[model samples]
Target chain A: MARVAIQHEDFDLSNEIAELRRHDKRVGAVCSFVGTVRGREEGTHGPPVLSMELEHYPGMTEKAIEAMIDEALHRFDIFGVRIIHRVGLLAPGDQIVLVAVTSAHRGQSYQACEFLMDYLKTQAPFWKKERTPQGEQWVDARVSDDAAAARWGIPGGNG
Target chain B: MKIAVRYFASIREAIGQGGETVETRAETLAALRDELIARGEPHAGALARGKSVRMAIDQVMSDEAAALREGAEVAFFPPVTGG
Candidate 1:
């Protein structure tokens, strides 16, 4: 199985997690994160979102994610990692991303999961454009996300 | 040197094209950007200075200081927003 996947199809969390720890006897912990599209991003009173269209640099997207997974493995004592990100058109409440890690202990997997997510937020070459009643608008990168990656001693401030 | 340049997201839309091959005397990424901006029109407006543009070379995140190489693949885009 590929450690990183960028596709238009939805992923099954249970199946992915199970596959991560399947043949590994040393696996003692599993940690995962899921991201979803919401009706409003800024505030509850913000314009209701109709859908989200995602764009990615095909060759670079896969290469960048694979490199980060290698970084995660080097930094943490993790047994496996699986990341899936959906692209194309998606509606509110639809699943958007998944990051899962397995390790011999809970702490490593937990930390690695967050680290990978932070890295993905800023470093990955994916763009999100939202459709609302007003029209389509590209989502802007947040400063907070930059700070999140910096906390891990990673330099990924693209904002 | 000649390089393949790619643009994404809003930058791609603003530039009105996805990519192009440029023949330039630029020694660095910053210089290459300036050369493009000097072309005027769509490039100057879309990739103007202080536009919060991000760059990559050979599929790796890079800064303006990165040196240019022949046959390199360079990309420009706004800051990423995907989760």
Candidate 2:
């Protein structure tokens, strides 16, 4: 089984790990990735970021992420998975994303963790707008993200 | 039909508005884009050649050929760089 959550508050990694491992005794390893709000908005075509406002289409975001996790489970042999993404006003150093996957071995866990992050990077509908010292600006979407999602052969990543 | 049009980034600044609803008879996204391009210098200039623009209809990524129904929300933005 897998757990996917998109929240506006911070999360406890230890708690999520314990929850994922509670029933799955065969889980021998866990792999995780946390995306933080960086001080600089890389690849943006505008001013530096003072702050960023994140927006997402409510029902669709969760559904898309769940489908992505489902695909990850089908492609990789993993025991459990958990994804936590935060929305709303986020400042630099704030934890914005979390991905965790567990498997009997570290290999599968690592692959699954990477796969989930890649999928979220391109597939998720969230958008970010940064407020720079010069002026407020919206960040441009990256083409590399599309290429990253293409590795999985999923559609709609080209955006 | 009345469709709410939203703009972001340089386009928003160039146009001096965040979003607005517009009445149009265009039945497809392509026609709507053309209509927007013809609006004025700001709209025309912002959407001019070599611009890296992306669009979403009702919050989903959409192409120029995507069908436009009545009252759909359309958004135009520059490329997204968020992770």
Candidate 3:
């Protein structure tokens, strides 16, 4: 299976996990993460988000995520990795991203999964724009995401 | 040298296009950005020094000090908000 995919369509986690672990007898643990669109802004009393538009640099997005997965493989003894990130317009509750990892143990898979996610959040070349009653606005990068990625000792300038 | 300049998100919107090819004498991304800003209008405001802009060279996240190359694909945008 391809290590990374940037699509406009939604993904099925079970299917992806199955593909990642297929024919791999050494795999003893599987860990996955799904990020979905939120309906409301954190501090805004404004109308809830009606929809969101995701934009990404096509070539760069895939390359960046693939590099992150490579880093995960190097840092953690993982067997396989798969990441899918959706683009285009999406509604509230729609799945935005997925990261799945397979390893010989649960601990490694879990750490690798979170590591890929943290790196992707700040490094990947994707941007989100939300539509609300107040009109449309581009989402800003969060400082917390930088802190999250920093825990792994990588600088996340996205903040 | 000629380079491909791409924009995304707010930068793309503000610049009114996705990308373009331009001939430039700049050697670094920062110099390239300053050259674009010298064009006035949207380029000046969108790529102003104080704005939080990020750059990529040949599809890799890069710093302003990164040197430019002929036929390079360069991108300028805001901090990413992806997951």
Candidate 4:
């Protein structure tokens, strides 16, 4: 399996994890994260999000994620990493992203997993536009995501 | 030097095109931006100094101070929101 994928189709978590760990007996721990679309917008009682349209800078998106994985490999003793991000139109409750990591122990896997996610949130070049009862709106970047990435000493200005 | 300028997201929407080739004497990303802004109208409005614009040089995220070379591809857009 490729280390990174950007597709419009929903992914099967079990299948992806299996493909990542296949024949890697040295991997004793696996950590994964899945981000899903929320039905409601925060702080607004407005109508639910009917669908979300994800847009990205194609070549740059893949390159950025690959660089993040390379950084994780340099910082941790992980055995494998897989990241999948979906684009195009998606409905509420649909999965949006997945980051999975494997290592000889849980410590490295867990930290690396979070590190990749935090990095992706701030550094990756992707945008989200939501269709709501209020009409179509582009989602704004969050300061919290920058803070999350800052914990790892990386400056995250995407927010 | 000649360079390729690209726009994305809101900036793309404002500029009405994804990319273009331009002839410029600007030696840095910031200077190139200023050159475009000097063109007036859409370029001025979309790339005004106060606007929150992010840039990438040769497909890698870069700051304004980054040096520009001939035939480099530079992109301007708003801050990214991805997971």
Candidate 5:
């Protein structure tokens, strides 16, 4: 399978992690992050989100993510990497994204996983639109996310 | 020269289209954007100066000062919110 996938299907996290470490005797650490759609935000009185629509720049989305994985490989001692981002209509509590990395040690695995996620947050070409009782609106980019990526020395949070 | 331009999310909604091919003499993304803005209406407003439109040339994130080449693919949209 390709290292990066932009799909509409919900992924099985365990299966993905297993696949990453399959047949690799030297692999000792696997770190992963899965992001899900939140129906409601904490301490906010806004209408609860009913669904989310994800839009992406097709060919560019996949290519951008693949490049990110390449960068991660170069910066870390990771052995395997898999990133999957789901698109289309999704209900609350649905999984939207997954970033999994495999390495020989916990340090490399952990760092690579976080690095990939921070990079994806600011650099990927995907846009999210939330649907609520009030109406549907495109999600705004957060400055904090930009800062998160910049902490890794990759500026331009795209926000 | 010819180039392809794409829009996403809110910008796509505002412009009422996803992408288009344009023929122009503009040498860079900034010049091309100015030319499109001259077309009036949504193009002028959605891609107006001071807007939060981010751009990429040939699928790589870049600044407006980056020179354009023939058949290059360009994109314009708001900041990305994806994780």
Candidate 6:
């Protein structure tokens, strides 16, 4: 099974795990990644991250992420996958994103977990702006993120 | 045709509004942008040359030459940095 959601609401980890394992008995390992709002700035002063305003291209964002999830499913021997991404105004320490994958063993689980995150960072069509003491500024996409995606041999792909 | 044009982040601040409907004979995304830039100094300064920006025509990725029709929604924003 494959699950993808672009939500403004928070999700329960245990419930997501349960949903992933509902029908599968051969699953032996479940790997997941949780993205949270951190306090420090990307590269500047460690400002208190009051909040982050996330704006996405709606339909385009969901389609792009769904495609990445499909790629992850194909590249690894995973049995199931789930991705939930939050949008709108989010405060610091709030859960921003989640990626969970399950498979017969740990190797596939770990690899899929890392791969999904790397791809999502570079290929998802979502934008984030941070609120600091100075003002709000748009976050710049990292070149290293592109490099990370390139290491996977997926060519000409960027959000 | 009249279309809703939306701007976000820096572009929004520069234009002082989220969006507005404009009537145009322009037929492509590039032409629409040129129309916006001709609106005044704010549009000209914000969407100036070499800015890292992307366009969406009715919620899909679009290029400068993407065709436009009646009642389309055109959105403009900087390159996404969300994780």
Q: What level of docking quality does candidate 2 show?
A: acceptable
Q: Model 4: chain B TM-score vs. truth?
A: 0.96
- Give lDDT tens digits, candidate 5, residues B1-83: 99999888999999999999999999988999999999998999999998888888988888888899999999998899887
Task: Report the TM-score of candidate 3, chain A only.
Answer: 0.97
Pick the winner on DockQ between candidates 3 and 4: 3
Total clashing residue pairs per candidate?
A: 0, 8, 0, 0, 0, 0
Q: Looking at model 1, how many pairs of residues clash?
A: 0
TM-score winner between candidates 2 and 3: 3
Model 3 lDDT tens row, B1-83: 99999999999999999999999999999999999999998999999998999999999999999999999999999999987
DockQ of 4: 0.78
Candidates 2 and 3, the one with greater lDDT: 3
Better of 1 and 3 by lDDT: 1
Candidate 2: deviation at residue A142, Å?
3.6
Could you tell me every candidate's TM-score relative to the true structure? 0.98, 0.75, 0.97, 0.96, 0.97, 0.81
Q: Show model 5 residue runs off by greater than 4 Å.
A: none
Q: Which ranges of candidate 1 are over 4 A from the true structure?
A: none
Ranking by lDDT: 1, 3, 4, 5, 6, 2
Best by DockQ: 3
| CA lDDT of every candidate | 0.95, 0.78, 0.94, 0.92, 0.91, 0.83
Tens digit of per-residue lDDT, candidate 5, span A1-159: 689988999999999999989999889999999999999855688789999999988888888899999999999999999999999999999999999999999999899999999999888999999999989999988888888889889886465
Residue B22 lDDT (model 5): 94
lDDT of 2 by residue, A107-132 (tens): 99998888887778776767787787
Candidate 4 has a TM-score of 0.96
Report the C-alpha displacement of residue A26, candidate 2, in angstroms. Answer: 4.3
Model 2 clashing residue pairs (backbone): A50-A131, A140-B79, A140-B80, A140-B81, A141-B79, A141-B80, A141-B81, A142-B80
After superposition, the stretches of candidate 3 with alpha carbons farther than 4 Å from their true spots are: A43-46
- Give the winner by TM-score: 1
| Model 1 per-residue lDDT tens digits across residues B1-83 | 88999999999999999999999999999999999999998999999997999999998999999999999999999999888
Q: What tens-digit string does per-residue lDDT give for candidate 6 at B6-73?
A: 88766777788888899999999999888878887888877765776678788766788999999999
What is the C-alpha lDDT profile of model 6 across A10-125, one tens digit per residue? Answer: 98999999999888999999999999888776687567778898887667778888888789889999999999999999998899999999999999999998888888887677
Give the per-residue lDDT of model 4 (tens digit) for A1-159: 789999999999999999999999999999999999998887677688999999899899999999999999999999999999999999999999999999999999999999999999988888898998779888888889989999999888765
By descending DockQ, how would the candidates be arranged? 3, 1, 5, 4, 6, 2
